[model samples]
Target: MTITEELINKINVCTKCSLHKGRTHAVPGEGSYNAEIMFIGEGPGRDEDLQGKPFVGASGKLLTELIKSIGLSRDDVFIANVVKCRPPENRDPLPEEIAACWPYLDQQVRIIKPLLIVTLGKHSMGRFLPGLKISDVHGQPKRAKGIFNERQVYLPLYHPAVALYDPRKKDILFEDFKKIPLILKQIKKSKNDIQ
Candidate 1:
């Protein structure tokens, strides 16, 4: 099997943490294996857990629209989560749960080597850029060391779910989404310049 497939298989049967016990299916993420951009979210919700897909609910619909706004489709980017399984009652994943699933996500990053990782919420953002408030940093891109790669680029954004509760956040998210193409272009240019 291909490496990505192997990883997914491992995730599917994972019992590294308590979160596994309640899952209907593990969401190992989806989309292009060779994508330039990877969107990482907090974790699976009820719909995602049942469907075994990332971002397939209402928030997912918004995420889809955001991706389209950038002139790309779900097929063009990778979508994954901090934890493969759903947290109980859609609660935030505990630190221990996140720790248990870290290896899988780390492996994914190494395999995809995406040029940019877009963190879709605080949990995903905290994993990379810890202690930073999403409100203070959303839409700004920063280069930092990731679990596997040095100089990884990350853009933090409020979780799409937030917009559902607050209409003002929806406007902010759209504005932030607009920065993606420019960020990608800048990352590509910088890489070429270095080469």
Candidate 2:
């Protein structure tokens, strides 16, 4: 099996964290193995905990609309959480939790080798855009080297859940998503220019 598949299989049966004991399932993530882009979120919610899938709650609906705005679907890109298992009461993933589950996320990223990574929340955002506050830098893109031996753009987008709680962010989010198509094109153009 491919590395991603093996990682998924292990995630499916993971019991490393205490979350596994209470979870209905481990939301490993889903989408094309060859996806050009990947979406990373915080962790499972009540809906996701029951469904064993990422982004299936109200926030998920917003996520779908955002994805559609940029001419993609959940099937076209991979989606995973920084933490595969849900924290009790949907609390923010703690530092220890994040530290523990990063291996899974790291392996997934290596396996997917996405041209860009769209971080959907602060937890996921901090992974790539360290030392930055989500409110201050959401939607701004940064680059990291050695992502599969190539630089990859990490776009920190507000989590859909943000829109769910605060309606004011919706317009800005739509505006931000407009950048996806352009960013992907630029990535290809830059690659060719280097050649």
Candidate 3:
């Protein structure tokens, strides 16, 4: 079995945090095993809690459109949240919750070894790019060193949910989404030139 599968199994039975006590189902994440891009969001929301899948709410629909704009689909990339369970009323996940859930995300990064990790929200941006403000830094791709052996690229982005409530943010997100295709192309071309 792949590392992702192993990690999924472990996450399915995770009880490291108090959030697990209220969870109806664990969102272990899902996507292509060979996906080059991985999207990491903050946590499951209400719709997610009901369906036991990550990003199933209206935000997810917007996310789908964003991915489609970049000439990709959900099936083309992997998706997961920083926290697998829903926090109460969509409140910010506590530091302890992040602590309890971090190892799983760490393990995921190792397993997939994605070419790029796109953080969708401030919290996820915190883990990858500490002390970075979402307003100033969204859409900026920084090469994060020493996370996994592969030296993955990290791109902090505003979450789709933020755009849902604000129309102008949606336009900004679309503009940022346009960058994905070019970025992926650069990575692909670089690899070919290297070889």
Candidate 4:
């Protein structure tokens, strides 16, 4: 089996953290292994934990709309979370939980080698570009070293769930979503220039 597949299997059986104890299924994430873009979120919620899939809840539907607005489908990009298993009560994942689960995410990044990683919230953004205020950097694309490979591009955006809770953020989210195509274009141009 490929390394990604193997890692998924390992994640399925992982008990490295207590989060696994309450999980119905460990959402190891899913999407095209060859995708050029990846979307990472914080962790699973009610629907996601039950379904064992990332972004399958109400927030996921909004996320799908955002992806569609960017002229891409879920199949065209990978979707994952910082923690594979859902935290109890959908609370934020603890530092220890993140530490335990990050290796699998790192491996996925190495295997997929995506040119761009879109962090869906502050938690996911912390993995790559920690300490920066999401308000200061949302919609801004930055070049950064990959978790396990060469330099890659990163974008931080508010989680789609934000719209559900606060309608004021919806327009802001859409504006950020619109920047994605432009960001991809620039990345493409830079790659061509380097060649």
TM-score versus the correct structure, for each prediction = 0.96, 0.93, 0.92, 0.94
Tens digit per residue, CA lDDT, model 1, 1-195:
988889999999999999999999999999998999999999999999999999999999999999999899999999999999999999999999999999999999889889999999999999999999999999889888876678788999999999989999999999999998888998988863311
State the C-alpha lDDT per candidate. Answer: 0.93, 0.85, 0.85, 0.89
Measured with C-alpha atoms, the lDDT of residue 73 in candidate 3 is: 87
lDDT of 2 by residue, 18-71 (tens): 788778989999998789899999999999999999999999999989999888
Ranking by TM-score: 1, 4, 2, 3
Residue 151's lDDT in candidate 4: 59
| Model 2 poorest ten-residue lDDT run | 186-195
Considering lDDT, where higher is better, how would the candidates rank from best to worst?
1, 4, 2, 3
Candidate 3, residue 108: Cα displacement in angstroms equals 1.3
Task: Give candidate 4 misplaced runs (Cα > 4 Å).
Answer: 148-150, 191-195
Q: What RMSD, rounded to one decimal, does every model reach?
A: 2.2, 2.5, 2.8, 2.3
Candidates 2 and 3 compared: the better one by lDDT is 2
Best by TM-score: 1
Report lDDT (Cα) of residue 189, candidate 3: 67
Error of 4 at 173 (Å): 1.2
Please say which candidate is ahead in TM-score: 1 or 4: 1
Candidate 4 TM-score versus the reference: 0.94
